[model samples]
Target: MLSTTVYKQLPVVSTTTCYQFVRLSSTLAAPQNTPLSHIPKPSKEDHHQDATFVEPKKSPFDVSTRIYTQQGIDGNDDARYLTKPTYPHPVFPTEECESVTVTHREPRTFGDKLSYNGIHIVRKLFDFVTGYADPSPANPKQYVGTRYEMTEGKWMTRCIFLESVAGVPGSVAGFIRHLHSLRMLKRDRAWIETLHDEAYNERMHLLTFIKIGKPSWFTRSIIYMGQGVFTNVFFFLYLLNPRYCHRFVGYLEEEAVRTYTHLLEELKEPGKLPNFQKMKIPTVAAQYWPELHEESSFRDLILRIRADEAKHREVNHTFANLKQKSDRNPFALKVEGLEEPQPNHGLKVMTPTGWERKDMQL
Candidate 1:
């Protein structure tokens, strides 16, 4: 059934086409000799795409965050071993974490007032942008609706953004004090070490959360802008009056404690967040915090982090109250045979607001 129209349309046939034509001609001429079963069948494909692409079930940015997966432990030859904790994380007593109350130190001074109010504004703006509202009893907008609901993704977004900025104050303060120590050729009264440690701890918090949640590019861009602006501005402000900066950080940590506390409360509710039910501790996290194991719950991780914020809140408020130049960091070392209880690294003795200079031995 060779058509003149078919030859005219192609103009010239390829070697493959000529070979196919010859085979067809021979097969027709010798149909009986070559059994009909030997001939090839022209098949029609089902749901085949010649020139089209399929969409992904999930968006690229909405996928799970990257986590560490070791091929197999080769006698402790792990890359994470190279990096050590600058300051060891204090172990939290389960009872102590349960006893953790959302506490705040009322702003007494002009600087404290400003720091307190500023944190509120920043938190309000951030909450609005990230589609997060505190579901705590204290929040005015607490309701039962999809819009009011806080998903795992939303919580992660809030934590990632909060932790990203939280580390900045400590780093800036530590860096400045370090240079000041070198320039003055005098001791920083152990302030630099504590400040650096606080910053490092906050960074560890960020790292742990990132393993659980992946932020979109839009969220990442916000982090970049926020970090840059905050670091530069905080640096300049600290130069003028370091006290205000500490106070601001103290207030900021207070908010962090409040936020995490709310998260813990939500986690207690049954059937709200199913993802967290099966969530395991990330390897990086378990390695950093010795107490954490494969079986540790996500809530356990948050408790430790909340305790950390409480510690930072205590430390920063104490720093704000003390003489930045002369006062010794009380948390760095312990004094023996003190008549009254003093501030320590762990939650053994705590001042919710902060320790006043009058009470401190130094």
Candidate 2:
């Protein structure tokens, strides 16, 4: 080894050069969160090239339209239950199913008259049939539907049959004397409108299901029976409320008779008779859900549905008599919030889940 004199040269690096090196390395190793840095350094010509990647567009009406499309979107996607098929023809193939279309009426303003003890369900019926939770009691907006390709006749049928019942004839000023005794008609109207709107959405949903050929027989009967059974029991519970004591029962009876008469009159129309007597309940029930008749038959299910409605009609008549016997005005009693006496029922159906005791807390 030869020891030689070496020139000592201090190597110096420029701050700009060091910074550029660091930035170039960082640019290549892209951080996962920010993609902007991941793009490779491109030539001027490369930047001019057209990019082809695009995202798919989605429809806001997907939820509502899903029912009409055979591909159901009601939480149940099992092919066995909801068979993918084309929409079925209307139950009433001909005649005025297209007549008197339903219009979106102005929403009613809610007030004391539309209170829980007033028009809104007197008491949330906590029965076994409901499966514990009331579907959309707290948030009625969940039931809304997209207004598209709906005919005027179907709209009218839905409005008259379900929406206008309690709000129009039952609670409107000219229709009932005590409806505005407390001057809560406007408020009551609003509440009724909300209920009606919700009902409309529900009906629309069901109709959509029918249109899409998903068989809904079992659920149809269950809903009809459940509604009737619960409503009948609730009628007794309602009788105990002072508001329904005297006039309430009579009003209900009169309404029932009127409805029956109207039904008969409607039957006289050339195309209405068959629809009236042979009303398809399952088709109506499908509006509520997909899995309702997920595993049931239409022929066997319709009988129970018809029977349930009959039972409801009978109970409504009985309640009318009870209200007359009580001799109290519904509006007056409602304003006071004073409950009437409960009926003495010798027969009590013991439930497996047990009844709500006086001190029982939910």
Output the number of the TM-score-best candidate: 1
Q: TM-score of each candidate?
A: 0.80, 0.23
Over the stretch 125-173, how does candidate 2's per-residue lDDT look in tens digits?
A: 3112221222243652332353321222232232123322322222222
Best by lDDT: 1
Instruction: Report the lDDT of model 2 for residue 135.
Output: 26
- Clash pairs of candidate 1? none
What is the C-alpha local distance difference test score of each model? Answer: 0.79, 0.30
In model 1, state the lDDT of residue 323: 92
Clash count per candidate: 0, 14
Query: RMSD of each candidate?
Result: 9.3, 20.1
Least well predicted 10-residue stretch by lDDT in candidate 2: 344-353
